[model samples]
Each structure stands twice: as structure tokens, then as C-alpha cells.
Target: MVGRTLTAVAKLSTVPAWVRRPLPAVAGVEDFLLRLYRRTESAEALAGFIALSWLGGEAADGPLLWAAPPEERFARAFLAVADALAEGESYPPPEWWRAEAGCLAPMTEAQWNERAGSWPERFYAHGVVCALGWVLGVFDDPAIMAPLHCGDGRSVGYGPREEWRVRLRACAVPLHLRNEEIAEWLRSGAGSQSGPAAVGAARATPSRSTG
Candidate 1:
């Protein structure tokens, strides 16, 4: 079925056919993801799969999934799928999901005006990701978060402690952080000045992977 709901995903108890239509190259990946869906019916895993479909099989920004409030899981079994998807890794949920989702939720509702001439900078399909569940944000080809600072252009939206491992592609970085540190950094005016320059210097750094 096309354009189904969370309720539908849980009810039908299977990955919708629409998602698997465009996918061809990955042998058995679809079956694996589908089995995982059928077994656990996780909201986050479903959300991640939907986002993967929208990304046209290319790694865009994330494997983002919706993590319902912990309070919601008292009766539901959604987290099981998220756990299975994670295999064994662990990380935290996104910042947006943890709170009441005050402003970020509204941004997802805003008009789809992002454009890049004939190309779309954001995307019309991104609505699906938000609709399935909230996405923290998309990073083109993000670097592993070294400092774990969600500064000007950098951000993180961690999932549950157990499920964090599954959402690593969501750019889960590790670093103990403090609000005061971010405030001081911004107040010092280092964000604007050093952000891009630091990025440039990082690019100039020897390739850790190659070296």
C-alpha cells in the first residue's frame, strides 16, 4: 500500500510494497528489513526504512526513526524492532524527540519553499520522513561528530539509550557537553568565525581513513 500510517504499519504488520518498488540493487536487503519489520513492527525501524526509500537508496542524512515517548511504550512493543535494527550498538535519541517537540515540529509543517533553481535543496519527499516520524535534520555528508557540539550548523537528535546504536547514521557523536559551553562559544563569536574555517582545516587534515 502507498502512503500508509504508523497505525497501518503496525496493523498490516509488514513493510509496504511502495517502499520496495524502487529498490533493486540490494540483494536480500529488502527481505531482511521486511522480516525485521514483521517481527518487531518498530516505529523507529519503519521510520528509518521510509526515510531510506525517500533517499533513493543513497545515504543522505540518516536512518532517523520516531521514538514514541517512553510513557507510550507501557502497552506497545515498538522498541523491540528498534533494538533488533541496532544489532548491538547503542546511542541516545534525538534532541527533538526527547522534549515536547515545540518548535521543530512546527518547522516540519511549514510550507515547502526550499528550492535550488531547477533543483530542490530540501525535497518534496522529505514530508514523508516527517510524517512517519520527526527527523532531527539532514546532513549532506556529515563528519563523525568529534566534539559533539550541536553548534550553528551542527546538531544531534539522539534516540533512546538502547536504540541509539541503530540510529548511528543519524550522526550520533559522543562528547560530554554543557549548555554553558555552547553559550560561551557563541557569545565569544567563535561560531561564525571559526566554524567554516575549522571545517576547511579539517578537510586539509590528512585523511585518517587513508593514512
Candidate 2:
């Protein structure tokens, strides 16, 4: 099954770069996440998995799947799987069942924020540790909020309450962008700088691992 999944992934990778360019950067991150899910089988793991998958890489069918919104039962089942795994109990559902019944429900922003907080501290710790790989301007892109909305209201609206806002705040300063540098860049008043430098400092500074 693993081999088959890898084969499928490889086949998908062969598609035109132009076509794939818009897809979320799921390759490296997804692979790591899948292993984590298989091992831990926790709801937070599943949430992260689905969220990342939803965000990464565009397939011909990608938009359609994403269009469904994370409100469906399938999304809920995935979360239940994570919950079961975290508890160290055998999954209560039947072998053929993947997720809990009626798991899929449209999330509100407030709900998403609640779940984000609910995830075991370990996952966020790991996320904060691994967040260094994100490139400059990655968080600045508005699309990053899509998966975060996974049935929650906290993920929407303008300004900082969004998941990206928190992630950018927690991860950006330590990973690539320095606080002083970011402040300077914001204050530069260059009438909107573009490219990498605008997102972060010219020099890449490694941050302490939250792990």
C-alpha cells in the first residue's frame, strides 16, 4: 500500500510544472505528516494532515475537493481518528470505517481556534520547531488560510486573529525574519517592497527550536 501510494505520488509529480506550481508545497511536508499520522493516529495529526493536504499542490481535481469546504463528515472522521489515537485506544469505528459518523461539519472561525488550541501541546511544539522550512512570503499569501478554516470561525476575517497571523507571529520571527529587521523593513516606506527581501531580512537567521 505504501509502495502504491508512493507510485501514485511520483506519477502526480510528473505533471507539468506550470500546472503544479500553484499547488501547495505538500511534498516534503505531507510526507513527513503522513508518517506522523500513521505512527500516532491522533486527531491533531489527522487535522494537520488534512489541513496540509488541502493547502498543498494543485491537482486538476484539487479545487473541487477544496471547494467542498471542510464541513463534511469526512473531515470530522479524520479528527476523530486523531482523537482516538491520542487517547491510545483502539479506534472505535469498524475496520471499514475511516472516521466517526457525522464527523464532517462546517466549522466556524471560533471553532477552528478552539481546535487549534485543543491539539496536544506536542504537535504545536513540533510545528513550531519544524516551521523553519517555510520560505519567505509563504505566510503573506492569503491562500494559507484555506485549510486553517477547517470548520472554525477564528480562521477568517481581516487582520491578526487568523491562523496565519499566529503562525507568522510565532514562526516568522524566529525562523527567517528577525524582529528588528522586520520592523525596519516595514518602516522602510519603500512603497511596498517585493521579492524575498521584502518578506524577510537579507540574511537567513536560524531560530531556537521549540521542540
Candidate 3:
């Protein structure tokens, strides 16, 4: 494990080139990338991090552009999903929708209720799941790279949350590595910027259960 991590750390310099935008000077961001890169043994996670970081850097980026503080909304939602997955729980739980409602200030329960029932946030949440699933090999289907259709009324294609939770546990990347990657992402400030890189439309069918 140490050797693999060292190998990943060794290639850290080259990661910047693949990212569409610059990573912020957030504390521990580099360390987070290093750990994620090491455990995943790929630069994809780093690239995703870079892409997702744009949410906090500017408001004009991705689907949440209308979000008052796109970064905060993205970060909160992403962490909710990541942490839930880490603990083997279903994501986008009812509580998550109503969580930190104050971020949008002046937002009442009724407003949160309306927003929570909306689709954009759900798209963001599923997008995070898809990105994580792809990188982790749980959604290793060839169609993963296809363009994502955010509000097209198409299904996520993933079978069920519990099913994937089992697959996540059985994946080549251990549960601890998953936890560590998320922890590092949050600690590095990248997570605070936003959660997992919402790559594109994740339509890949779930890979069969490994357990």
C-alpha cells in the first residue's frame, strides 16, 4: 500500500495539466489529491476534484449556478452523499434535503420543502454518485463517458442504493480507502469547495455485485 501511495504521490505534478481549471489554494488540497490518487491509482479523481473545485471559485459554473452560494450548496450536498455512502446508508435522505437550510438565508421550511422536492439538487446528488461509482469501478460500464442528460427524465440506471452499498464494500478499493478519500477531500478544502467532481451524465448500469 505504501509503495502504491508513493507512486501516486510521485506523479502529483502532472495532475494540474489534466484539470480544466486551477485548484484553489485550500489547505491540504494537495494532500487530499495525493491520498485519493494513491488509493484509486489514477489521476481521474484528481481531475474530478479540479473540475468540481470550480463551483467555489466562481458562481457561473455547472448546474447550481442559481444557488445563492453555489459552493456551499454543492459542498453540503456532496458531503451528505459521500458520508452516507461511507457509512453504507442511502443518500439524499429526507434530512439531507432540509439540512443547513439557513445557507440560503430567509429560506423557510416551506421554501426548503419546495427546493428539496426540486430536480436540480437531485441531479447534482446523482451526479456525485455516478462519478464516485465510475471511479470506484462499481459502474464500470463502457457507456459511462456518454453525455449526461441532467433533466431529461431518464433513469439513473443504477439498480438500488443498498445493492451498490454492498458492491462498494466489495470493491477493490476498501471501505477505509473510500472513507479516507472523502475525509481527505473534505480536509483538503476541495470538499468544502464542492463534493465529488460531477463529471457528466452517469447512465452506466450498475456492475454486478462482487460479494
lDDT of each: 0.31, 0.35, 0.37
Residues forming the 10-long window of minimal summed lDDT in candidate 2: 1-10
Select the stronger candidate by lDDT from 1 and 3: 3
Q: Worst 10-residue stretch by lDDT in candidate 1? A: 142-151
lDDT of 3 by residue, 79-183 (tens): 344334323333244455567332422334554344345444343334444443343334553133222322343432444333433432343344566789988
Per-residue accuracy of model 1 over 12-78 as CA lDDT, tens digit each: 1222343221123111222333334454444333443444343332322323233222222210122
Give per-residue lDDT, candidate 2, residue 103: 32
User: Could you tell me how far off, in angstroms, the CA of residue 184 lies in candidate 3 after the best superposition?
Assistant: 27
Scored by TM-score, the top model is 3
Cα lDDT tens digits for candidate 2, 1-211: 0111221121113212322222234334444445544544433334344344433334221111123332323333433433333344432434424335343333344533443454343242223212211222223432332222212222324542254345433432333336567668668965265656655753465677999
Error of 3 at 34 (Å): 25
Q: Candidate 1's error at 91, in angstroms?
A: 21
lDDT rank, highest first?
3, 2, 1
